[model samples]
Target: MQSLTNRQKRFLKSKAHHLNPIFQVGKQGVTDEMAKQINFALEARELIKVNVLRNADVDAKEAGELLQQKTGAELIQTIGHIVVLYKPSENEPTIQLP
Candidate 1:
């Protein structure tokens, strides 16, 4: 995934503002199952927020990188315990990033 421009990042940040974390990285860290689910979510939603549990072995940043590597999604940012990801859809893309 390519790096997002400031404008694109701002656009995505606003779009993600109200989204809840549908995926969570738990104590087990970024497992295959989690990566699969994340891929599914990205395929469906294009953008998603992932919550990193407090007791998780990996920090939010590490978990974000792991997910990025596994799912080939772009890591928008890791804020607090939240990891935000975005991947432009292969078919019908929804986000028209500036």
Candidate 2:
């Protein structure tokens, strides 16, 4: 995945504002299975939110970075415990970044 520009990130942030977290990171942190699931979700939705529970071993930012590296998704933003991610689908993408 290529790096997103500020404009694109802002656009994605707006698109993601209405979205709820589809995945959660707990005490186990980021697992291989979770990364795979997130990757699949990104392929379908292109943009997604991930929540880091209070019981998570790592902070939301850390977990977001880990997920970013594992899934090749851009870490759009991390607000509170919610981590926003964006990745254009290789097949048919739904969201078009500006």
Candidate 3:
């Protein structure tokens, strides 16, 4: 997927604002199974959030980047322990980019 532009990122950020984290990263870190689940979620939701627990081995940013690579989703934003991710759904795309 192509890199998201600043405007697109901003738009995704807003679109994701009302969403709650659908997954969490803890001591196990970003497992392959977790990545797969996230990938599926992105294909369905287009945008989603992941939360990093306080006891997580990796920080939010690291977890976000790892997931970004694994799921091929754009890292929209990271605030504290929350990681926002976005990807256009292949089957039925919902969120349109600016």
Candidate 4:
């Protein structure tokens, strides 16, 4: 996977700020089904936010890493229970950076 440049990363972060999480990781957290859904979402939308529920035992960083590894998406940012990720679409991307 290609790494985002500092400028691109910053741009993506801002673009994702107002967007709500497309998927939520709850107590079950990062299940195989969840990973598969995330992968599909990333393919349709280049940038997406995942909300980690408070009850989940896993730390945010660990969850983010696992998601990145499993979905082949870049970890754009993580604040509180919210994680932002990016995976450029193979065809057309729904979200565009400035």
Q: What is the clash count for each candidate, in the order shown?
A: 0, 0, 0, 0
Q: What is the overall TM-score of model 1 with all chains considered together?
A: 0.95
lDDT of each: 0.92, 0.94, 0.93, 0.88
Off by over 4 Å in 4: 94-98
Off by over 4 Å in 2: none
Pairs of residues clashing in candidate 1: none
Please write out the lDDT profile of model 2 over residues 1-98, one tens digit for every residue: 67888999999999999999999999999999999999999999999999999999999999999999999999999999999998999999888767
Query: In angstroms, how far off is 94's CA in candidate 3?
Result: 0.5
lDDT of 1 by residue, 13-76 (tens): 9999999999888889999988998888898899999999999999999999999999999998
What are the per-residue Cα lDDT tens digits for candidate 3 across 1-98? 88888998998888888999999999999999999999999989999999999999999999999999898998999999999999899999988788
- Give the range of the ten consecutive residues with the poorest summed lDDT in model 3: 10-19
TM-score each candidate. 0.95, 0.97, 0.97, 0.91
Higher TM-score: candidate 1 or 4?
A: 1
- In model 1, the number of clashes is 0
Candidate 3 or 2, higher lDDT: 2
User: In model 2, where is the ten-residue run with the lowest total lDDT?
Assistant: 89-98
Q: State the displacement of the C-alpha of residue 38, model 1, in Å, after optimal TM-score superposition.
A: 0.6
